[model samples]
Target: MLHRSLPIRASLLLAALCLSTPAWSADPIHKETVALTAGKAAHSVKGQIKGYATAEYTLTGKAGQTLSVKLKTNQPSNYFNIRQAGQDEALFIGSTSGNTYQATLPADGEYTVQVYLMRNAARRNAVANYRLEMGLRD
Candidate 1:
């Protein structure tokens, strides 16, 4: 009888724990291709984001070429991450570092620049308007 009661108590505790945990409301991620001018090495794009929504821009790059990214945003919590085509983790984190990132690409492939607001701002439904500038050169 005691064992049965213990199991019930454990189940209730588990349920409470699950309910107590805060859940994030998922928002759809926006996608776009970074199109540069036919004879240009850089391009800039303007966009808006809010909540948990994200904007991802895909661009092609080559190894040994310099990749530069600058994100200008209306909100301080807004940031971006750069990830190689097949990677799970970001190669650059804008939140920890600043909003500008420049590196010599490691491989020749597609890269994604993801823009979003921090959780603190996202949860508040704050909006951010931004301009993302990207360039690649030798």
Candidate 2:
């Protein structure tokens, strides 16, 4: 009787584990506002992200201003990208090894910096803590 009950116990445990974890679990995208001034202005933010999570920052600058963005994370599978205001695509995409990008503002107005964990990493139940640094150099 004891040997027969062992299999049922293992099956119940497996079902409980599966039910505890959802395929997708995350909050809404987090957003932060920022500002850039000429001649070495900088800003920094820290946050934690779970699987399938994203955080974004918004700022406005002149047409000719140069902007730089860098992200440091506990997990190496996170990156950042830049999207111009009113545009549907990113101006530049960062690689897995390097989560940084710099460019001159093309038409001024507002821009968005999006930080997210890679799709593979986000699919897991891991959480990554990160620090994002943004700056402007005149």
Candidate 3:
């Protein structure tokens, strides 16, 4: 009886896991560096991602400075997140908070900006054409 129930329990666990939302930090499929003009503190970039694809942008910033990010996309299911390098959790979740993010730096180092579509949209092979604006100010 114990051995028979083991398979049943494993199947149930698998079902539960499949029903949960996907982990927000999917491995990015694209990467780029956010470059600022010689004297400028802000810049805007455009790109497109589809399905479960993700684009990551890295930028360097100093502690005590403020970082601002705005994402405008063609699909409402598209979103972005911000995280410091070597971190697993995100500092901002666009799907829950909104498309814009603003926060003061926590340390002086590199940060990543990730853009992708929600699972619901990604599973449907939806595409997101987006303009991402970023700035850092003292």
Order the numbered candidates by lDDT, best leading: 1, 3, 2
Candidate 1 wrongly placed segments (more than 4 Å): 1-25, 36-41
List per-candidate RMSD values in Å. 5.3, 6.6, 7.1
Model 1 C-alpha RMSD vs. true structure (Å) is 5.3
For residues 10-119, what per-residue lDDT tens digits would candidate 3 score against the true structure?
A: 99999998888676756448999986432365799999999999999999988888899999989999999999987788889999999999889899888999998998
Number of colliding residue pairs in each model? 0, 0, 0
The collision pairs in model 2 are: none
lDDT of 2: 0.83
TM-score for predicted model 3 compared with the true structure: 0.76
Tens-digit lDDT track of model 2 for 47-137: 9888777898998888888888888899978888888988987787875337877778898798898888887887784688999888887
Give one digit per residue, the lDDT tens place, for model 1 in 39-101: 365799999998889999998888887889999988999999999988888899999988999
Candidate 1 similarity to native, TM-score: 0.78
Off by over 4 Å in 2: 1-27
What TM-score does candidate 2 get on C-alpha atoms? 0.76
Q: What overall lDDT, based on C-alpha atoms, would model 1 receive against the true structure? A: 0.89
Off by over 4 Å in 3: 1-28, 37-41
